[model samples]
Target: MNWDTIQGNWKQFKGQAQQKWGDLTDDDLDKAEGNREELEGRIQEKYGRSKEEAKKEVDDFMSSL
Candidate 1:
């Protein structure tokens, strides 16, 4: 699904996201609140990834689901 669909169904996807990015804290997910940009920022902070890298990772994650 696309980011908008994923955002709308964040509750369903939250656990999967946590599983994918184990370093991200619960509070980080809470703050993200289904915002792709926010989640990407959190991933970048926690994983020391470049913005493009994070976006690519997120895209891959979405595709896997």
Candidate 2:
């Protein structure tokens, strides 16, 4: 699926995201609100990953979905 679909269906996907990144709080995922950049930013902040790595992680997460 595409980003738009994911964004529109964010409420449902939040649970999956939380499962995939267990360290992240519900607040963190809620803050992302299905925006890819926000999600990557939160991952970078929480995991101390490089921006490129965070983006790649999100891409992988998207693939899994």
Candidate 3:
């Protein structure tokens, strides 16, 4: 989904996001608040992944939903 769709559906999406990326805390999701860049950065930091890897992981997780 696009950023707008993700933002619009964040409440529902967050559960799935948590399941997919367990390292992400609720605060991280709240802080992200549908901002793709922030979410990517948090994922990268939490998972110790490169930017591309984090983006790919996020993309894969979202696509799976």
Candidate 4:
């Protein structure tokens, strides 16, 4: 799915995200609030991944959904 569609359906995807990245807190996802940059940032922070890596992971995850 596209970024817009992902953002629009963020709530529905949160569970999957939590499952994929168990270290991410509920507050982190809340702060993301459907924004791709915010989600990427959270993924980076929680997973200790580089910015580009986080972005790529998020992209891959969204594509899978």
Candidate models: Cα lDDT each: 0.95, 0.93, 0.88, 0.88
Going through the candidates in order, what is the number of backbone clashes in each? Answer: 0, 0, 0, 0
- Candidate 2 regions off by >4 Å? none
lDDT, candidate 3, 1-65, per-residue tens: 67689889999899988888898999999999888889999989998999999889878876887
Q: Indicate the residue-level lDDT of 57 in model 2.
A: 93
In the range 1-65, model 4's lDDT, one tens digit per residue, is 79898789889988888888889888988899889899899888878999999999988898789
Using all chains and alpha carbons, the TM-scores for the candidates as numbered come to 0.96, 0.95, 0.91, 0.92
Pairs in clash, predicted candidate 1 = none
Report residue 33 deviation for candidate 3 (angstroms): 0.4
Give the per-residue Cα lDDT of candidate 1 at 3. 89
The list of candidate 1 runs beyond 4 A from truth reads none
Across 1-65, the per-residue lDDT of candidate 2 in tens digits comes to 77788899999999999999999899999999999999999999999999999999998988889
Clashing residue pairs for model 4: none
lDDT of 1 by residue, 1-62 (tens): 89899899998999999999999988999999999999999999999999999999999999
Clashing pairs in 2: none
Best candidate according to TM-score: 1
Q: Which has the better lDDT: candidate 1, or candidate 4?
A: 1
